[model samples]
Target: MSFTRCSLFSRQSSSDHSPSLLFTGLRWTFGAIALSLGAIAAVNTIITARTPPMGPRLNGLFGRYPARYGDLAYAIGGEGPPIVLVHSLDPGQSSASWRAVFDLLADDFTVYAFDWQGYGLSDPNPEGLNAREFGAQLRDFIRDIVGTKATVIAHGSAAPLVLEAAESGQINGLILVCPDGSAPDEPRQTERAEFLAQKEISDRLLEFPIIGTAVLNWWRSKPNLEREAHEFALWDKSQVENEARLWHVAAHQKGAQRAQKALLKGRFAAPWRELWKNSSTPALLVWGRHARGFESASEWGALRPDASLQVVENALLMPQLDAPQEFAGFVSEWVKKHTE
Candidate 1:
């Protein structure tokens, strides 16, 4: 999924960029801006939802299949060894998160990307599919439809699933982009402990009514939501669509909300120290320099002889979106080298 800042309102203005003023009033200003932006986005979504569908036909890219979670939808294309791309649980991104890379690679490889249940066009998963459950579905997807061991690529929250799937011998190759739950080199034990504790607290906060409404509103608010939708479509001015915006609105739908809640509760993390200690799949770890997590890509690389890490300068969370051509070139060359 793409990265977009949450908006909130504040009394401060952008003109107050003075270092001293920022030092003294940064917190309040940031909060206010966030609030205002969030409110704007939420209102825009409400209005947009009420209007008729305004974008071009999405075409017949969606396919339906039944899984334990209910009906699931996917879009497949391209022409090489099957590559299954899994977008993260990031709030607003769906298959479009891989749009840039998808278009570029589809010319060379058979690309299969899907909307995870409760996230996009796919049916909701009330039980909230965790990595374990996701891995089971992945096994079925590869063995049944792809018809061969495929290369698995994931961004953000799905890294754990890709890792677990590879370790379990479900796939032959793995790629993790801006993965969450990553630890930095020389990580302070306190940081790790705090992360563990904060995850639970954050989950709970998102579930609370007043705070949750504020958070969701902020997430859906105007310039913020617009930017989020734009980012998912790779910030390309031409690619922006009403459906992308609608997807953002649909994200707050009952089913999607349940999935969001489930995600914050640690449905994606798995203790994998031992698993990494003896894995054989070749992995390529790509992270954005601006991404908060995954600071120690090199350290992770050191853990596995075949794992390589590439840090894309200035890319926030979705490097594929942030630097499409570069990522496409890398993926093209990488798959060629590793896929035999």
Candidate 2:
């Protein structure tokens, strides 16, 4: 009789057993809650990773809307003719790239150093990035802020943009430092075409969301920044630690990747030689002794024979940062000579 009763209890309908049913339901509920919490945590982490806070730095004043590309961050000082300094379009570069030489030039001329759109303290563009759009923004900035024909000093990628503006008669004079264009080896038309094609293919990969973000982040990482600062930007290794910190901070700013991605996709490509060949504006070409790209200063000089050339010894791409005194003296003397 006892064995029969035990067997009957075990065979009873599972649904009729409250304790067992309750335990199963509780297990499922707890699992769902845990998964939900984990999902929320994951989303929060991604958000935090993507949006980094910008630190406090001097950007001077903001030039609003009608200037194009929303707003521009610019600083202006001194009492002489306006000299607008356009910074390179490198991933971690900004107007602050000229910080070492800003005050020096300001003492002699009305110096204007500005962050291009999607850089430094300037507003980022949600639409998209293109050279034409940047040229328009620069034209508007010159018209609205400088309020007169100003001398434009452009570096690296900014060189082509300044050349375009000069072609449109927006600037009185032009100075290019380590401008990007056709490489010396790629001087032939077919070679230039091949270079552009290769660049387009490489740059297109950076437009993908996951891959592009990862690539850009890696490129701007602390280690890479330190190496680049020491090898490419500054002549002295001792200066890299501090500059790398600043560069890392700048690279993490929200929307910083947008400009880089756009640039990588060939949005800034132009016929640099054609622009240089046609520009009648008095120009100065400042090259670092160790600068890359141009194989011969004489070749670049021949492009604009009327333009003056100055080479800063023991410097890499950025003489303004590496040799500020010599760079500023040359620029000051050039400005004085040309503006007169």
TM-score of each: 0.70, 0.78
Candidate 1, which ten residues in sequence have the lowest lDDT sum? 51-60
Using lDDT, give the best candidate's number.
2
| Per-residue lDDT over 1-340 for candidate 2, one digit per residue giving the tens place of the 0 to 100 score | 3445454346666667757656877999999977865665565446448655654253344344445456787888677988999998877788888888888888888888878888887877654667767877788888888889999999988877777677667798888998777423445776888877887777777765555566777777779989888878777767889888888878778777788776766677666788888888888998888877656567768988998988888888888888999899989899888864
Task: Give lDDT per model, in order.
Answer: 0.68, 0.77
Q: Write the per-residue lDDT of candidate 1 for residues 157-231, one digit (tens) a residue.
A: 777666677765668778888766542233378698877677668877877655665666566554566676465
Score candidate 1 by lDDT.
0.68
Candidate 2 residue spans exceeding 4 A from truth: 1-52, 55-66, 182-204, 294-296
Task: Report the Cα lDDT for residue 263, model 1.
Answer: 66
